[model samples]
Target: MSKIVILGAGHAGGSAAGFLKQYGFEGEIVLAGAEQIPPYQRPPLSKAWLKGETNENALQLRSSEFYAENNIDLRLGIAATAIDRTAKMVAFDDGTVEPYDYLVIATGSRARKLPLPGGDDDLLLELRTIPDAERLKQALGGGKRLAVIGGGYVGLEAAASARALGAEAVVIERMDRVLQRVASSTLSEFFTRRHTREGVIIRTGAEVVAVSGHSVTFADGEVLEAHAVLVGIGATANDELALQCGLECAEGIVVDLDARTSDTAIFAIGDVTRRPLPHYDVMHRLESVPNALEQAKRVACAITGRPAPQDEVPWFWSDQYDCKLQIAGLPFGASAQVVRGDSDTGSFAVFHLKDDRIVCVEAVNAAHSFMFGKQAIAKSSRVDAATLADESIPIKETLL
Candidate 1:
């Protein structure tokens, strides 16, 4: 029987293993993961789970019995030490070697650590893993103050949760706006106002100069005292195993259009894979659950001699308090950003245009418009801001 081994049991790894069977591949499958528990969903790690509204069982992607029933082998908590392409084997940290005909590397990323001036790992924590959230939750214990280092998704979500827990949350972002890297400035402004109303101090263009114990010093000589600090700053790709195998590495392990690495026999997906998008013809490493699942399905289809699905426009969303923001497509060099509705009323979409082409759409508390915009962009259709602003035109027609 042909054997397939997959590394990292996150969304991509779990989906890849499940799809192999869905496609009627009569082969032995092994899933190796570094986490001690079964495969779990990551999207909630920062939001629901942090709010104490979720548990480990809710985070699991699959039940424990799912593996045994499907005849799939799951090796949890076993870190893949190296991949030996010559022998088609994977070396584990425990000195065990597993041979396979096909391999998939989905090792995601580690939370980028912030360099503080003091030796205070106790006060500073990152919200990447479950344990991290648990520790932060225990620290919250009702009323307190939390200083979030980055104003990105992770940071803002942390700030929102801190506020939900009845804590005074202050978010300090180096950029002039929150979520500036992913969402448009208009969307950022909407969220900034929302956070401000919730009693969370939103500071923009403020860089953290140093951190000593529970005190954070800003570049402008401003300092604040906090009970605990959550570093939601950024992430760094885990490429040690790939580098050991001599695979082409850039910011991540470089993969071609079909998710093939320098070695065609191997494949990389999710945040760790630096692959090129067909629509834009540019390399991108997106960190979203949708992208991970899509890449996994595509790689599985290719391996099983099935036709790959058409690539859809990439998108992501975040839930902070009651605000639901959704974004579609990548807006590179977007020359103009137009708002479709009243910004203060809590419903709007930021239309992005470049030389008259609708490159992307940022919707705040507007799921209908966001979904329609995603479909429009996926079909490569042209949409005008004037019609988009007018609810009478209807966004669904843009796809037609």
Candidate 2:
């Protein structure tokens, strides 16, 4: 009987173990995780969880009984120390060694911390784990003030949650506009207006020189004092184990479409992999839950000798206050953009077209537009910009 050992009990690792069992793989499965708790959803850590709208039980991916009933060896609170590729064995920090026929690395990503002079890094709060969320939640309340360092999705979501909790929030972004790296200028402007309307102060073109205690100093000789400081800049892929084992790595651990790494017996998945996109020639490291689940399925299929799952267009979603932003596909090589609805009413979609084919769509509080764009991108359907812009015409009619 083949035995599979999975590292890092995040969404990808836990889902991979479950998929293998569901696909009738009679192998010995061992899922190891450094955290004491079972796999849980991370998306809500900055929003619903932080706002006290959801509890820890609701965030779990599966109950503890599910693992035992499935006959999976679920090892928690144990970290993998090393991997011996030749012998196909994984060493744990608890001084135990597990032999495996196939190994899966799903070690997700970690929050990136900003190093500042005279700044106590320990005082800077982050929302990557449950413990981190608890700390941040405790710091926010009726009269508390939160100073967010980054203006990305996580930072903005936390700000919105803080406002919902009757706390003051001020977002300081180093870029000229918020969400400049991931979103278009139109989106930045829309979110900026929305956040400002909610009484959240947004500082664009602002650079933080140093942070001391609850005080943040800007390069322009401006200082802002707050009750708490949050660093939500970004995340770095946890590829140290793969790198130590001599796997091919770029921005992340390099993997094929089947989630197989440079070594045929070893597979990598989730936020730790730099995988090839479906339609594009470039490789991307996606951090969304959908991406993690897709890769998990891919690894399971590959190991179980089943047919590969169909490629899916990458998508992401963010909830801020009463607004929902759903994005489909990457806007790479797009030449034109069309607005489907009115932005003033807070229900709109931006369609990005490349050579008349729909490449990407950013829908705000518009589910139909998001669904249409996702299907269109999957089918590589061509669309007319003029028809897409005309709200009078139906979205289906705009497709060519």
Question: Best candidate per lDDT, number?
Answer: 2
Quick one: best TM-score, which candidate? Answer: 2
Query: For candidate 1, what is the lDDT?
Result: 0.83
Report lDDT per candidate. 0.83, 0.92
Consecutive 10-residue window with the lowest summed lDDT within model 1: 391-400
What are the RMSD figures for all models against the true structure?
A: 1.9, 1.1
Task: Please list the residue runs of candidate 2 whose C-alpha ends up more than 4 Å from where it truly belongs after superposition.
Answer: 118-120
Q: What is the lDDT of residue 181 in candidate 1?
A: 79
Give the C-alpha miss distance for residue 386 in model 2, angstroms.
0.6
Candidate 2 C-alpha lDDT tens digits along 215-248: 7999888889999999888899999998999999
Would you list the clashing residue pairs of candidate 1? none
